[model samples]
Target: MWQHLSSLRARLSLLLVAAGMVGGLILAGVTHWPLPQLLAWLHGGMGQDAAAPTPVTATATTAASVPMSPQDLYVVLAVGLVLLVLAAIWLAGRALDPVSRLLRALEGAVASYRDGDFSFSIAANRRDELGKLIRMHNELGHTLREQRQHLAQRELLLDTVVQNTPVALVLTDASGRVAYANIASRHLFNEGRSLAGLDFAELLAEAPQVLRQAVESGEDALLTVDMDGSDETFHLSQRAFRLQGRPHRLHSFRRMTRELSRQEVATWKRVIRVISHELNNSLAPISSLAHSGAELARRGDVDRLPGVFATIGERARHLHGFIAGYASFAKLPAPRPVAVEWAGFLEGLSLHCRYRLASAAPERAGWFDAAQIEQVLINLIKNAHEAGGPDDEVTLSIHDGGNETRVEVSDRGPGMSETVLAQALLPFYSTKRAGTGLGLALAREIIEAHGGRVLLANREGGGLRVTLLLPTAKAPPRG
Candidate 1:
């Protein structure tokens, strides 16, 4: 009942009317009622006959009483109630109007928040508590909106960095699941989806131990991993760091294959510089000594001259060949690539050796120049022939790989030692007694210039295998 009464406009109006009615009743009891009763008493006591009623008339002096007829009193009370109700209605509407407007604004604000519109703002023109609350809400919403924008931008920047970094980058979650990988990382790892979700330990099994140390210590780690099924090398850097309050591991990879190649070139240059200096120093004196010996022999001191002259001439010839070999390492010509048929090329190369074909040759060929490829083939074939035992066989084969043409020269001999195999391409570093150490190095330089690679590995059974990979022309015969 109280709840119903509290919600009723009429009840509120009635309460106001009741207050005014109580006040009017008090005034009536104190003024009109008492005075009338007192005048009636006075009239009777002043010798006016009590049996006859005193005549009353409507005048200013008798306006309060005139016996106050019941109908007139009823009309006065009704007028008073009506005036009180009108005042109550006006006062209530005036007091609650701002509240009703504020309630609507609050509803709109909530709806905006629900719809993810943080831009909505409330007006705070009043100096009341409601106004202060609106001001605070606006301030809070502005802060939250700014924070959301900052977080979004930060996320975008991180994504761009991961996608476009030059080094191969891989990100892993706290539990070691691969979460993201960049383009370079995919190409370097060589396994499609290889690093994704794979345990770091498994993915980096071939990596050096430093990588594990870095992860455990929460510091950057550096290690080298040899590419599987290829001769390429990579330098891996691993670091553990936090991203947006979550622990993550990032691995950066750089291909060291080219670095190794550059090192080989530098080492060869150093070797040539030293050998050239020494050979020139030695050859000058030997030539002079040979000339002096000839002069002495012409002057009749023939005995000493013969031994000295023979020694000088022989030493000069040896020094000449040594100098020639060193010069060859320094002066390899640039490759000029052109198309050549594989069958005819091999047949021509075979003319330089007394070799029999073991199988039918490939009909189609690739885009390697004849002169350059011939030099590479002869060096490899000669090495195979020299390395093979008398009864052991040497085989040369050509076949088509998907994007490349491969040429393999195999020799059945005790394969190269690990040390020799590792350093075989180094200039002036040869195992053969007669070798000047420039053959394999020159071959590698030439082939690389032609956009090809040379690989030396041990054959499955018991020999050294030299494989040449050359990029083929587009749209080659599929079969």
Candidate 2:
């Protein structure tokens, strides 16, 4: 019965009633305390005489003669009223004690909620309003738990999508600060540090215009960011949206380097097609003219025929050289590697290029091929020598790097420009005055066939450095 009233509303109601009763008692005492004294004084002032007469008169006279004091009467009445009020107050407090306890429990539940503890519950077995309240509290807790679980699942799904998405994705806030970055985005941008809270513009300094436009328009924007110090391209896309009632932007990046490479290859193929058609047309007529001139010369028709033959021969030789260069580009044979002692091969190459090597600085030595490798070395050395001035020197160094061997040919010449370096391996792309540009192209083709890579870079001090890396041959088993 006591526990039935133990609720916030019940406790509040009890407290209000107790306060009102106390206030009313205090007010009544203040107003009525002096009334009894004033009434006694008024009765005394009425001047009624008292005398001892007969038997009835004697009893009245005796009661009148033994007069009661106003102070004593007031004290008696006040003490009785005080005792009654104390008993009522004690009973009321006892009745309200359960309510006070229930209020405390409710307060504890609210405090736990404030502290982020959502698992607390209140017990109520009574069939009253307090029981209904407890049931509601339990229901509220269940709803909160379900909501929390749903939120957690949503976050997990978002994480999985971000990690598995093929395209890179980065999310930022209204202030352009990075909020989240997917795994693909981090890999594509080469971002090692945590992306959260980083300024988007600072991260994408390579292409700030895209970020700026996205922020300004609050919409999706597409742009390209060219990777520095590499032959890679990235396609960037920025999108804006609201998340959890706050505006955010997402930036996506995809590597488009392969696409660009395909486009360059297509362009080269078209150029090759046009050159082949023109060269064939020009070569046919020149070959026929040269044959006719040779016939005239054979008939012993003297002076005019001799001059014509010379002219025909010169034109035919030029055409022949042109055709040969074209054929070399057209017929690039695939590589076939065979094991050979690389050290002895390089030594033979040095001897073969003895004239150029004698003039060059002392060669740096290691291990590489003899015939095929020598061909690559010879081409590079010739190009280096041609590029270097008479007083300038060309240097060749061999490096054995455990798993692979490298041959470096460096020259103290004016370094190649960016355009030249980019297109050096392209057929017919030459910087020389009277040279066929198929040398580097053929050298590259041969090196690639041998499972090697050729790299060209400008030297720090001056000139260019060409590095050739070849895999080392595995040793045979012991006999």
Candidate 3:
């Protein structure tokens, strides 16, 4: 019952009832004792005065005016008090009605917000604290609604992009079930059928062997597959991340055939231009020299003939060497693998290039084309020496991975810019005035011929680091 009376309305009703009871008791007491005694005293004093003789009619009138007994008056007062309390309670209920309604509205609005329906608001029509609270609630609702609208629009835009993008995107849950697949992925894997809830492995069951192998490897790879009798290349990228405290994976496949074709055309154009320019450079000087030599012969200037022949021969040799470089690049042969001790290989390389050993050479033997690898290292070390760093700071390190050998040459010099690093291995790309641009390109070709790769990156603090990753066993070289 006390808990029931805890509310404002119940407490107010109780206070009103208590005030009425106190007032009724005080009225009953005064009317029953002090009021009647005072009247009797006044009447007695009037009768005792000799000059002011009371009329018999006046006394009768006064007796008549005393209407009821004290008992009857008490009853009437109690009934009045009861009626007043009932009226007060009714008034209190009316006064608190608006507040009760406001409380209910607030509850519903909160529930709506919790349910992600931010469109609910309370009406405010007063200039009091309660009204102020209602206005604030409305403002909060408005803010939430605006935020929700903006969020929905953003989500729609993102979904549209993801759905329409050309790259095939697939998202898988921890159990390897396909949770989401975009339009491209659906078309590529299942003839435009939805891929949700399907096994990811089953999707690859009918895929080309190259793609399956690449995906199974769980690493970024570029693969070529024969589709409809034509070869197409794709680059696959995979990433794993946690979503809502659960693991998920994203796989992306981007077709690179068209892009690679464009790049190939551009590379051949560059090669042609370089060859033509070199040919013009060497032929122009030789043509003038030949004309001068013929003039001397016609004049019988025998003494200058030998000097002219020497210059002509030198020019011929330069032209021959330039053509030979291109021919060697075009006709690079497969690498002949051989087991070579790292110590002996490093000793042999040290004879041709100067470098500081950054770490001890791996004791394990390396399996690759020894002569080709030596040439690649020689070219890289030469580049480092000429890279304008301190000669002593040029460093070489070797790591013996279980299945691969890594050889790194680092130099403390100005590192390559992003653009230079990107195309550094492309044929005929050079920065030097007299560079043939064949050294790094030839090195890349040789290493790739040995079924290896060349990686270039800017080292921390300064300079460039070139890494050659070669297989540790005798793997047949790629043609």
Maximum-lDDT candidate: 3
lDDT of 1 at 136: 86
Q: lDDT of each model, Cα atoms only?
A: 0.71, 0.67, 0.85
Q: Could you tell me which residue pairs clash in candidate 1?
A: none
Candidate 1 lDDT, tens digit per residue, 163-227? 77768888898987777888777665545455667776566554545454544565453445434
Better of 1 and 3 by TM-score: 3
- Candidate 3 local accuracy as lDDT? 0.85
Q: What stretches of model 2 exceed 4 Å from their correct place?
A: 1-301, 354-369, 433-435, 473-479
Worst 10 residues of 3 by lDDT: 60-69
lDDT of 2 at 245: 95
Query: Can you give the TM-score per candidate against the true fold?
Result: 0.43, 0.41, 0.69
Q: Against the correct fold, how does model 2 do in TM-score? A: 0.41
Q: TM-score rank, highest first?
A: 3, 1, 2
